[model samples]
Target: MADTQTYKFNVGMTCGGCSNAVNRALTKLDGVSKVDISLETQIVEVQATIPQADVLEAIKKTGKPVTPL
Candidate 1:
């Protein structure tokens, strides 16, 4: 499998807590390497070896709307 893959998300995280929430959720997934959240941009950039579907599920589990970036 690839070492790193980028997955962009349209996460509506309004505060630092929201960002952290999304970050932690993504970090807990199977093959995530790192997560970069931009509150200003409303985007959660992810680096992972896991599938996008899994990542999406994790994001959805946060109880916030997310879309591929």
Candidate 2:
């Protein structure tokens, strides 16, 4: 089995809608086991076995700027 990894991203999320958008986008990607977003902190946490680049691209598709932290 692939190792599970946790990735933290700083995303510009304004509300629940923004966080939900990010969550939806990320959940569509293969190997993404879970997603956790904190609107208050504007942070997105992902648990997955996928590559970081792939995850970044998925988040970008949500139309939000994301930075690795």
Candidate 3:
């Protein structure tokens, strides 16, 4: 089973389209099972077994700020 991890991103994503941009970028990474992003709080909730380090890197690849919660 994959573990669910919640993260907060500091990127300035102001719309649903921006959310989709980040989602598309992160979802392509290996071990990422799911992603739920909130533009209001700039948070991303992910379900995956990948290491937090890899996750962070993947999020950065999307040009977003990601912090563990």
**Which candidate achieves the best lDDT against the true structure?**
2
Best-to-worst ranking by lDDT: 2, 1, 3
Model 2 worst lDDT window (10 residues): 50-59
Look at candidate 2 and tell me the lDDT of residue 16.
Answer: 87
lDDT of 1 by residue, 1-69 (tens): 676889999997888898889988988888898888889999888999988999999999999888887
Q: Rank the candidates by TM-score, best first.
A: 2, 1, 3
Per-residue C-alpha lDDT of model 3 across residues 1-69, encoded as one tens digit per residue: 676665544555778877887888779978877888878887887777778778777777766555666
| Candidate 1 minimal-lDDT segment of 10 residues | 1-10
Candidate 2 at residue 11, lDDT? Answer: 97
Whole-model Cα lDDT per candidate? 0.89, 0.93, 0.74
RMSD of each: 1.2, 0.7, 2.4
Index of the highest-TM-score prediction: 2
Model 3: colliding residue pairs = none
Predicted structure 1, TM vs. truth: 0.90
Query: TM-scores of the models, in the given order?
Result: 0.90, 0.95, 0.72
